[model samples]
Target: MLSPSSDSPADDVIRALADVADLVVVPHTRLADLTTLRIGGRPRALVECRAAEAVTAAVGALDAAGVPVLVLGGGSNLVVAGGDLDLVVVAVRNREIDYRTVEAGGAEAGGAEAGDGDTGPGGIVVRAGAGLTWDELVADTVARGYGGLECLSGIPGSVGATPVQNVGAYGVEVAQVLHRVRWFDRATGTDEWVSPGALGLAYRTSVLKNADRAVVLEVEFRLDAAGRSEPIRYAELAGRLGVTPGERTDPAVVRRTVLELRRGKGMVLDDDDEDTWSAGSFFTNPVVREGDLPTVRSRVADRLGVEQAEQMPAFPAAAGGVKLSAGWLIERAGFSKGHPSSSSPARLSTKHTLALTNRGSATADDVIALAREVRDGVRQAFGVELHPEPVWVGCSI
Candidate 1:
C-alpha cells in the first residue's frame, strides 16, 4: 500500500544502512500494525535494525537525505495519522541485560545512579539494551531484589522509549535512576553517551521523544541491590501497600501491586479487552493557573450542582497552578466510561475514563473523531483545555 510520492529518498537511505549492517528493510509497513492503538496508516519505508550499529546507520542515512524518520521502539506511546504517512520508520530491536556489575547496597541517597550489583566489585549496574521490553526489565530488576523500577511495572513500551518520555507511574519517573543513554546523534553523525539533563527530561517529554533528534541505542539504569523499593510517594499506592508516604518496601511486592492496579484500570494491555487497546491515557491532567481554578470550579458548579463541584478533584501544584483530573472533568461533563455509543469502533475504556480505545475496527480517523468529541465536550463544559499524552506523528487534536 505504498503511495507514489515524488520522492522515494527513504528507500535509498535504508538501502545504504542495510549494506553496512544486518538489517531488514521493508516497504509499506503499516503504522497501525505497530501501535497498540491499532490506528495510523502506512509508512513509505520500514527498516528493522537489530543491532546498535544498524540503528545508527539507518537513522544517519535518513538524516543525510533530509527524509523525515520516525524512531519506532515499542510503538505504545504514539498516535499516527491515516492514509500514507510521509516518513520512514527505523525500529530499534537490539536487546540485552547485564546485571553483572551491581553493588550489594542501596542506591545513592539523593538521586545519583546506583552501581551494578556485581558483588565482587567497586560498583555494579544493570544494563539493558534499548529494545528490551520495559515491564520485562522491571520484572527482572524486582526479581533480583532491586527497586527503583517497581512502580513502573506494566507500562507498555520499550526501555528506549521510557527515557524518551521520562516515563513515570505511581510517582516514580525514569529520571530518578537513568544512568546514561547511548544514542546516535543525527546532527553530528556521532554516537555518544549523554546525561538525562541533556535530553530535557520533564513532564512526559524528552528530546528523543520529540522526533528523530537522536536514536537511543541502549540505556543503563541504577538500581538498589538491597532489594528495597524506592520511597513510595503516591497516596493511592502507599495506601494499598499499607505504608505511609516516603516508606520503602520489597521491590517484588511493589511490582505486583502496581501491575494489579494497572490491570484494574485497563492500563495493562490485554488482547481480549477492547478497552485495553489504547495508547494508555489519552489526555494528561490539565494544570491551570490558580486564578483560573475558581473559573473552572464555577463552570462545574453551573453545569452540575454546587455539591458536585465541591466534590471535583483538584490538587495544588507548583508555580501557582492547580492540577485537575481530566477523568473527573470528563465524567462530570456527562461523558462517562464507555461513552458515546459502544457500537462504534472507538470508545472510552469501560474501566478507565481517561483512555480512548479501538474496538478492533477503529481507523486513525475514528479514534481522532472520538478524541475530538471528548476533548471538545470537556472544553465546552469546563473552561480547561486538556492536552493528549501520547506523541502524535501526522495528526493533531
Candidate 2:
C-alpha cells in the first residue's frame, strides 16, 4: 500500500505474494531490462508467475494489500519513468495452446470481431495462453496452413496484451479476431472470460490496457482452417498480394508480406538493429473533425506549399473524423528520420519518423524530451495534437 519506497516494504510485499504457490519473486529488477525501449528504472519488486492461476493470485493479493502493481507481458508497449519506480511488477508467463477440432463448416474467423461470418470450413479454434509471444503464435498459425493473424505478423509483444490495446498492424486489429479474453479481475478477485464487447476496445485502447484493472490470462482466436486469410483491408498489403481490398489469400503469404512491410518500417523487433529499438510508433495518427478538414488543409498549405499540402495523407475514420499521418507531419515539420543528430541516445528512428528510439544508452528523460519536442513541433506546425501510442508507466509526456 505504501508503494515500497524502501527495501523493507518491497520485501514485505514480495513475502506476502510469495505465500501463494509457484510464484518466483525477485527484488530490484531494472525496468529498462524488461522493456523494448530499454529506458526505465528499477521497480521495488518483480514477480514472475508460470501459470495463469499464479498470476491471478499474485495480482489479486498485491491489489488487495493496496500495493501498486504493473501487469507486464513482454514489455513492448510501455514507457516508464526514471530513477526508481515504486510498484511491483507482475510478469505473466503462462504459455499454452489448444488447437483441437479442425473442421469443415461455417464459423467466424477469429470470431465475430473480424466482421467475417463462417464462410468455408468453420476453421480451427486455437486458444492461446496469455503469455505466448504474439508473433510466435502468428508463425505457428501460418505454419499449420491456417489463415487469420497474417496481417498482424510481426508485432512484438505477448498475446495477452493484444486485446488490451486492440493491437493492430497492416489492416488487421486484434478486435477483429479476438474471440474472448480470460482475465483475473482485481476488483472482484475473480478470474473469468469476457466477450470483447465488454472490453471497450477502440483504436489502440481497451479498458484493461493501461488500467491494470485486470490481468489477462488467456485469449481465444478463431482462424481459418481452410488455410485462407481474412479479407485484405490495407492498400499496401492488398497491392503486394495482388488482390483488391476485402479479398482473401493464402495466410502464409499474407504473414510473409506483412512481416516484410513491417521490417521496412522498422516495426518489427530486431535486437541487433538500432532502428528497431523502439516501442513501435511513438504517436497515434491525428484524427480531425470532418467539418474542420478544409481549415486543416488550408493551414498545411500555408505553412508548406499548396502542392505539398495537397499531397498530405488523409483517410476517413470513425464518427466523421479524418485521420492524418503523424509521421508525415513530423517529417514536414523538419524532424527527419534520425533527427536531433546521429549521436543522441534518444532520437527519431532512422527508418521511420513515427518512432522514437533508445540508441543503446537513453534514459526515460531522454525519450520523454524527444517525444515532447516532436509533439510540440507537430502542434506548432499544423495545430494538430499527436498522442503517444504506447502506454506510459510511472511517466507522462
Candidate 3:
C-alpha cells in the first residue's frame, strides 16, 4: 500500500496514483503556495482530487497507510508553520454546483424561510461542491436574484469550510442558510448527507471543526428566491444598506455594501496590498458570562471614560453570556492598528485592528510572536481570553 508521502517514502503510492485519472499529484509544492497568510512549510506531497471518488480514495489510502493528512480547501483560514511539515496535503478541487427553486410549501430547509422577511415561503436551494470559492457562490446567487448568502459576501475560503466554521458576517451565519451537507466519514469510509442538527453548528464552529473526523464533499444552502436579503440584523451592515433592523432588502444591494465595507477594512484579498495578506480576523469575539460584563465594562470605562465604555460593542450570547469585540479589546489593550511600526514584517493591518498581517517577509515565528503579544496583552488588561479564529497547524497560541 504505497502512499504519496515522499518523506514516508510513498513512491509506490505515487506510482499507484499516477494511474488515477481523477487525482493529480503535484510534487514539491509548499503550503505557502496554497495558504492566504503566505507562510507555511513544504508538505510531503500535494494531491489534488477533482472528484468525490478521487477524494475518497486518496484520503482512505493515506489514512490507512498511517500517514498524517492535511485537507486543504481555499487555505484562507489556516496558519501553518514554516519549514518541512511532516504531513501530506490532500487538496479538494471537485467543484460542481446545482441550483433549484423550491416552490412554496414544497421545501424543507431547517427553517431557513420560516422567518425570512414576509415573502411567503418559497426559496432556492443551491447544492455546491465543497471546493467552490465562498464569495463566488455569494456572487452567483446575488447575480441570479437569489438571497441568503449576500450578507456573507467578501468572506475568503471555500464552501466546505463554511459549515465547518458556521462562518458569519453582517449578522448572517452559514448555519442559518445551510440545509444539508454531504460528507465522507473517515471512520466508516462511507459517504452520507446529514442535516444541520447533526453538525452541532455554533458560532464560528461545528462538529467538523478541529475534529478531522469527516470531509465535507458538498453543501446545500436554502435561499430566498424573491431576491430579498435575510432580515438585516447586524447594525453596521444594516446601516450601510439603509435598512432598519429586521427589514429585508435587495440581495444585490446587500452584496455590494458588504464588499465595500470589507474592502475598507482590508478584509478582501488584494494581491498588491500587504494589509490584505492576513488570515482575516485573528480572533473570535470573546463570549463571556453575562454577570462578568459589568466588570469588563468598568475596565473599559476606567481607561477610555464612561462614554466610550457605553459604546463598546457588546452583544448577547447563549446562556446569558455577553460577546465582546476582540478588535475593541485589542485596540484598548494598547495594540493599536499597525502597532509598534509599519516597517515590521508582521504587524496588525493598518485598516483593521483585528487582522494580523504579513508585510511580505514575515515568517511563522513573526506571526506567532505578534499573536501571542496581542492575546497576552488583552488578557492582562481585561482578564478575558482571546481565542484565535484560524486553524493553526504545527503551531499553538
Candidate 4:
C-alpha cells in the first residue's frame, strides 16, 4: 500500500481505498509498463484490485469523488498519451475460472461440473474472471477437449476486454459464443449479468468502448461439447486447414494453425520481435456505404491498374456497408510494409502493413505521426478514411 504526503482529493481517495481488502495502491506506475504499445507516461496513482468487489469498491469510490478513473486490464488495446496523466488507474487482477454443464432447456448444473462427461449434450459454459488473460482461457478450454475459441487464439488482452472490443480474429467474433457478462454499472451502482444483445457488438467495437459506462467483472462464453471447432470462415485459415469455408475442424489443430499464422504476421507478442511491439492492427477495416462502393473502386482503378483494383478485398459488412481491408487500402495507397525507413523510430511493421510499430525508441508522438501519415495518405489516394481501432487516452491521431 502506498501513502501520499499531500492532502489532494485524489490522494485522499487512494489512502482510503488502501484500507479495503484485496486492494493495494501504488504511488507511481507508468502506462508504458502496463500497455502492450509500451508507450505512455505515469498516472497519479495505481490501484491494483485483486477481487471483483475491490474493483467495484475502488471504482465506485473514485467515481463518487469526481476523480477520473481508468479501468485497466491487460492493457492490450490502449494508446495512452505521454507525460503525467490526471487519472487514477484501477488495475483488475482477479483471476478465477469455472466451467458448468448446461442442461437441456438452458438450465445450469448445480455447482461446477467435473468428470469425463463434463461437456454434456447441452454444451459447456465457461465463467472466467475478467482479469484472466484472454488466451489463457482459450487454451484451457481447448486442453479440456472443448471448442469455439480456437479461431480467436493468439489474440492478446484480458477476458473483460473481449466483450468491450468485441474482439474477433480469423472470422470469429466474441459475440458468437458470448453467454453473458457480469458488469458493474457505473450509473446504477449495481453489478449484474447481461446478455450479448445488450452489448451492441459490432466490428471491432462495442458500447463499452471509449466510455466509462460499466466495468466488467467476469465473462462467460459457451463452448462446443463435442470438441469440434466453429465452422472455419476465414479463407486463408480454411485453406491452410485443407477444408472448404464453413467446415469444422479439431480445436487443437485450429489453435495451432492460428498461432502459427499470427506469429508469421508478427501479431503474437515476442520480446525480441520489434514488429510485435504494436497495438495490433492500428486501424479497423473501413466500412463504406453501399452506394459509395463504386466510386471508391473507381478511385482504386484509376490509381492502381484495373486488374489490381478489381483484386481488392471487400466483404459485405453485416451493418449494411462494405468492409474494405484497411491493410489493402494502405498498401495500395503506397505505404508499403516497413514504411518511411528502417531507421525511423516508428515505422510500419515489417511483416504487416496494418500494424504501426515502435522500434524501441519511438514515442507516442512518433507513433501518432506515422499513423497520421498512413491514414492521410490512404484518404488522399482512395477517398476512404481509416479509423484507429485502439482506444486513445489523452491523445488522438
**Can you list the residue pairs that collide in candidate 3?**
2-13
Better by TM-score, candidate 2 or 1: 2
The 10-residue segment with the lowest total lDDT in model 1: 115-124
Model 1: lDDT equals 0.83
Q: Which residue ranges in model 2 land beyond 4 Å of their true spot?
A: 1-10, 102-121
Residue 48, model 3: Cα distance from true site in angstroms: 0.8
By TM-score, the candidates rank as 4, 3, 2, 1
Q: What tens-digit string does per-residue lDDT give for candidate 1 at 298-364?
A: 8999998899889888888757788899999889888898987779889999999999999999887
Decreasing lDDT order of the candidates: 4, 3, 2, 1
Clashing pairs in 4: none
lDDT of candidate 3 over 1-397, digit per residue (tens): 2322433545456557767768999888888878889998887788998887788888888877777789989899899998878777888888888886665665545443332222235767888888888888899999999989999999998888899899999899988888788899998998988888889988899989988899999888888887889999989988877779999999999999999999999999999988999999999999999889889889888888999888988889988888999999999999998986978999999999999998989998999999999999999888889999999998877
lDDT leader: 4
lDDT of 4 by residue, 197-303 (tens): 88898888889999999999998898998899999999999989999999999999999999999999999988899999999999999999999998998999999
After TM-score superposition, what is the CA distance of residue 92 in candidate 3 from its true location, in Å?
1.0
After superposition of all CA atoms, the RMSD between model 1 and the true structure is 3.7
Q: Considering TM-score, which of the candidate structures 3 and 4 is the better prediction for this target? A: 4
Q: Which of the numbered candidates is closest to the native, going by highest TM-score?
A: 4
Residue-level lDDT tens digits of model 2 in 1-397: 2344565544666887777776889876888889999977878888999899899888877776777888888999999887767788999888998774433554443333332223335557678989899999999989999888889999999999999889988888988887778888888888887878889998888998668688899998878877889899999889988999999999988888888999998989998898998899999999999888788788889998899889999999988899999999999988999999999999999999999999999988899999999999988888889999999987889
TM-score of 3: 0.94
- Of candidate 2, the 10-residue stretch with the lowest lDDT total is 110-119
TM-score, predicted candidate 2 vs. hidden true structure: 0.93
Q: Each model's TM-score?
A: 0.91, 0.93, 0.94, 0.96
